[model samples]
Target: MNKYKLYSSTDFLNDDSFVEWLLKSDHDAEMFWDTFVEEHPEKKNEIEEAVEIYNHFKFTSEDLTLEEVFAIWNNVKHKSVEKRFSFLTVLKYAAVFVLVFTTGALSYYLYNNATEETEFTIAENKPLNFNEAQIILSDGKSVPLNSKESEIKYDATGEQVIIDNDTIRQAKKEAEPTINRVVIPYGKSSQVTLSDGTQVWLNAGSQLVYPSVFKERQREVLLIGEAYFNVAHNAKVPFVVRTEHADIEVLGTSFDVLAYPDDKMFQTILVTGSVSIETKSKGLLSGKNKMVLEPNQMFYLDKESGVNYVNNVDVATYTSWKEGMFDCDKLDLSRVVRRLERYYNKQIHIKDPLIGTYKISGKLDLKGDISEVLDVIQSFVPIDWGKQQNGDYFIVKPY
Candidate 1:
């Protein structure tokens, strides 16, 4: 007997087999659904609607509560063209529920009871622990690069990837555009040239998710941690960088974005050209919540206190990391050490709280060893460091 013969969109959403097929986890489930869809063409609309919801929500039956189910049903009922319907109407109208699902674009959907906009989380389930930098292809294949600093270049067609000396050819399907991801763990960095000629320098402990080829309408990429972008000039198709808190839009601009998930503040520094930062509370197309930044201007947002402001500053203070150096303009010692920890993949603790408040100024050549870098920092501040038994370093008052 075909159990899914009379199944509605809601029933399919509640079924585990359907979810497995949607996630492409079970081959048998995929075959079953394919054959069932062919045999039961009447349910094609229902399955399409359910797939849209599943892709946008990424929720399973357990994630949805009874009240939430009722809400979905009520939403469908209210939007249905037929004012009157039976109890078994199903959730076919959910496809028209004003959800956002663009191919190869950063997701901006509703969540936490489907009330507000939910940003795309970079590494919600997976931890960043790869020793080597890697590129995760759309087909779930991971290509690892074993260099301290890797260079990646995508051809104009986005069908070929050149990683250092090796070249990889990837087949593209027009129906399903590919979205590639680059993950640079601690102690490593990567420079990627997108298909559109945009250049991006990804810092350590950072990840960037971008499409293999940009769509005609726009070019957008999702960023976590820090990156410096020299975007290509394409006024017809604006380039956008999306972080957890804000989306930076620019036609062709050079900027630095520091948006580490663990960091309390999200910052954007415009080195050249102009860009607009839009928070999640406001729509991207709307100008009400957009903060425009001119060259040499910076936009800062404190994720914890919900406070944000703009300041004019030297662009080198924020962008020198990509040039194999760190430029400090009276930056805090604690902030400097944090970057060192990520760049060296080592743990360092400040035993005294007051030491963290010490301001440091100057430039640091990051190509040297951690000990050498610490020595340079020591020259700027009165601090001494000792190694613990576990290989971790601790900062204390000078002996």
Candidate 2:
């Protein structure tokens, strides 16, 4: 149940969970509304009013594949504005639908209009510090993965960590299994095939920690940075990805998790299947701390403040880094420079903060030199830069 006590039609309809239940018959929605009505009969009239508005909109989600949903959304995109509510109706509100029973199955609804063919653009973000990938084994051996296509695989018996025939480390089954870690620094990334056939692409400056083998009922891993997961489905066993801000309960899905420790926001984008992101909080006025995400939806969490938001976005933009390419749609110059700074391990100072808000879009291959990459960005936007005597680069809006 939403803790704020939704009393308006816009509040109820804006909630993805309410829409899911109304359109898809979600069980949690079924249970939640029933209990909410019983507890607060006074607000019964407002709940019904919200339902009436939802019926007027006539959105449907029965057996529609993700592609079809987007197609329908695109077809109606122009029409939504023509209608009475307009897209303004979907603007920011706390759905807050997850309670103890419902939180387990909660999924958030995103607010993105970009399709797969659509480019992604993010601006004003900072960079990382890295140059290569390293595998830190349980036995204290450090193996360098210098190749672009570096692959690491662990055996099911918790026996070996293999990069080709080279065994980075080995542990006896009789001994206590020590967890291993993979470190991928900026300017480089690596892929790992877990024993269960699950594939993960660790993005630049990301770290993944997991046991050498599966743990009976659960397959859990910790991420200090970003990664793309194609979780091998085992209905009896659930795969969970843990980060500093939230716990992503994998529901047999392919998704991307961006949770860098230095970054303030934690993001998860679902490409296929379903997943629930759960956050915990205490206080009388706090809403149920859960939001389940659907495919093509991205959930964003503000780490320091514990605020949550969801948006519909293209899956390719975030996942394309795994393909050795980076796509920015309309991202601001500040964020683009940050990414470049990490990739090149250099300093880029933007003297005018307003200049960083300028938007640009392009696709750049990671194989290019940092200067060449910066040159590409420069061609599209009105900006100038020069290097100082001490080697730091200063970016400024021309006089």
> Which has the greatest lDDT?
1
Cα lDDT tens digits for candidate 2, 14-56: 7777766676565777888888888888878878888887778
lDDT of each: 0.79, 0.69
lDDT value, residue 356 of candidate 1: 96
Minimal lDDT window, size 10, model 1: 100-109
Clashing pairs in 1: none
1-399: candidate 1 lDDT, tens digit per residue? 288888899899999878766755456877778888899999999999998887786332222332254345444534454565553544345553323111112222223222433332221122223566888776656788789899999999999999997999888876655778898999899999999999999999998888788767758788889999999999898888877778898999899999988888899999999999986542222222579999999999886545789999999999999988999999889999999999988999999999999999999999999999988888889999888999998899897
Give candidate 2 misplaced runs (Cα > 4 Å).
1-132, 282-288, 389-391
**TM-score quality measure for candidate 2:** 0.64
Clashes of 1: 0
